[model samples]
Structure formats: C-alpha cells, structure tokens
Target: MQTLSRWENTPTFFPQFRAALLEHVGSSATVVVIGASDGRLVLPLAAAGHRVIAIERDPVALQGGLVQLPDGTEAHAAGLVERLQQEQLDDRVDIVESDFLDADLPLAARYDAVWTSCSWHYSANHHRPLADFVTRMQDLVRIDGLFGAEFMMPVTARHYLSEHYTSPERLGPYFTDGWNIQLTLRTGQFTELPHIGQPHPHVHRMGALLATRTSSVTTERA
Candidate 1:
C-alpha cells in the first residue's frame, strides 16, 4: 500500500495518458475520475469544458480546497481546486470524498468516461475480486463509454505475493465480455513507488489499458 502523498507527488505516465483519455472522450463530456486524490485529471477535464465528478477517499487531500457533492460528501484538494476556481471551473467540477467501490453513486449519473490512474489496484487490496472490480468499473459507463486505467503489477508471480499484485497479461480476460479493448500494453521498464511497509521504493512492472464499453446491461441517461 502507498499513501495519498505518494500518489500526489510521484511522476508517472500521466501526460501521455491524459492526452489519450481526452482524445477518446472528447470535450464537454461527462467524466468520472476514480482515485482523484488531487484533481490532476479532474482539473484538466473541467478546464477542457467537460463536467467532471472527481472521487477520492482521502479526506486529508480535501484540506484547503473543498467541494460538496450532491450527496453532501465533502472533497478537498486545495491546490488543484484553487487553480480550477481561478480558471472559473467550479460549476463544472463535482468532488466526492468517498470510496469508489462502496459509494452509493447515483445511477442516473452514468458517465461518458470512467478513468482510474494507477489507483485501481486498491480494490484488489481491499479483497474485492478482480472480476467484480472490473464489473463495477464498467457499470459506471454508459453504452459506448470509454474506460481507461494505468496500474502497476508484478512481472513474475510468486506464491507468497498478495493477490492484489497480478500479471499484466492477466488483465485481458476481464475486459472481453462487452468491451472493445483499444489499448493493452505491458510496459518494459521496472517502476518504483513508495510503499507502506517498505523503507525503500517498491519496484514492479507497469501496465496500461484502455477499453470501451460496447453494450450496457442497464439503461443509461445521456
């Protein structure tokens, strides 16, 4: 596990990932940002004219800058929200301080795109099955909506390793049911990030996936 501080400060493949997401979802679309600790993705989406719902569980991140969601949950990310306010983007951005897996999100708020950046594995850590996690993610998207995620997984599987860490190739089967997988790449470089139990940086293999929901089991309102 890693702290929210690590997520906020660490540099990853964010620049390129952001560009790809924007291109796929287009401007002025409704977007749901999972694990939006500091509005990195939310600020950009709102700035580009999209209405964004940013979800983060860390209440500490909500300090200084706070916003109330429709359900009355308060979310904070002082620096980023302040920048959005300076750009006059408050009206288009909704911040929710809730756990993505368990939050009782409004079904009517189905989004055009659901994006999680390097934080999706938190579900597996919480004991949720990977299949169920994938299902929950796809449920948030409307028909033909986009889903994108970038996560770190183990390169070589070990018996003692936590189930939360999986091979990059293992992610493929989960997206096949009703998804049009657009991009699936296992990165070549070993990655390092701060971990809770380790004094040194934890290293792992990285993976990125982008898929589109081709069919919806439930009705969605546009």
Candidate 2:
C-alpha cells in the first residue's frame, strides 16, 4: 500500500460510495468518476481491477503540484496522475484534466457506473442549472448502468433556496421512466474536521442516491 499524504489521506465525502460500487459494480467494469480529485476513489477502483475514467478540473488536483496544508504550510504533494503512476495503475485510468461539464468527452462513451461526489453543489457549477448536471450524468449511463451521486443537502437556511443543494426525493421528478431507484440515503447535520482547503470545522448534511437506468434510448422509444 502506498503511504498517503495529508490531502490524499482525506476520506471520501460519501463513505458508502465505495460500498455501493463493490456490491453493484462488477469486476472488470469500466466506471466514470466525476470530480475525481487526487485519486481518492479512483485508485481503489483501479486497484480492484476496474477501468476508471477520471474527470477532474483542477490541474493541481490532476497532476502533482504545490499545495498549502491546513496547518498553513506550503508543500508539494502528489496528485491523481502521479499517484496512479506510482501505483502502476496508470494504464487502468484515463485522466481528463478539464471541467467535467465542459470537457469534450467522447459521445460514444458509456460505462457500467457513473459517480460524482459533492460535485454539482459547488458554486463553480452554479452557472448551470442542477438539472443540466443530472441530465449530463444520466445521458452518460447505458441502460442498466448505475448512476450514483453523493451530495450536500441543505444544512443552512440559504441552502434551501439553491436547487443545487438538494436531496434524492427532490430530484425524483427527473426519473421519467425506465429508472430504478435502488437506494436513497441522507445524513443529518454533523460537524466535520478541517482538511486542506477546508481549514476550519464545519457542519454538513449529505445525501446519496443509487439508481439504474433500466432501458436504453431505443427501448425507451419503442
């Protein structure tokens, strides 16, 4: 096992995201991960013998670069690309270092599973409506493929007004047909320890949804 750096040591915002993958995603499957920062989930999925297409926007997060730690010290740390290379998992991943929403992804691309963690909730993506994000992710899934997302639910008064900070129940209307919602979970507000960019303690509520598209375009239109 490779030793993890401070930033690299950070656990995923959604703990069950991996569990869902292990239980639902098959071995040798090809998975697409949105916001795959620094191989947090990418490395493990690759290590499990799955091919991963990681889309990350930050160049520093995609490639090793200087970073300021939570303790207010600057240090050079390895990124997803470097970690994958060091772990000999480079061949298993195709790293796309561009904004997930704007990246010129191949139209033919489809996967066994597509996952995003606290992605759309970011202010950076607020320029686009939340539905746009879900639609894009949905379009990328093949029939019977899994669509998983762990997001920040409304924790503050201001969050309720922003559609981006929503829950699975609120997103239900998007599932017109041929979609099976396997599980939907939410965590009540909890305080989290600070790390890297988030240098102070904060409270957060999270939500997760695991659904599968049951029919393809041809089948849906039939």
TM-score of each prediction: 0.74, 0.90
**Clash totals for all models, in order?**
1, 0
| lDDT per residue (tens digit) for residues 1-222 in model 2 | 393744454334445656666677667778889999888778888888988999998888877798877789888878888898889999999988778778787758677888988888888899988878887788888777888898889988889989999998987776758678878888888888888788898888888888888876421211
Off by over 4 Å in 2: 5-15, 22-25, 217-222
Q: Choose the strongest candidate by lDDT.
A: 2
1-222: candidate 1 lDDT, tens digit per residue: 011332454545555555666677666688888887656667767767878888877764554455553345555536445555666777998888787888778877678888877775554344665565556777898877887777767555561264455544667766666677887766665656543223466556667778877876432211
User: Best-fitting candidate, measured by TM-score?
Assistant: 2
- Show the lowest summed lDDT stretch of 10 residues, model 2: 5-14
Q: Over all chains combined, what TM-score does candidate 2 have?
A: 0.90
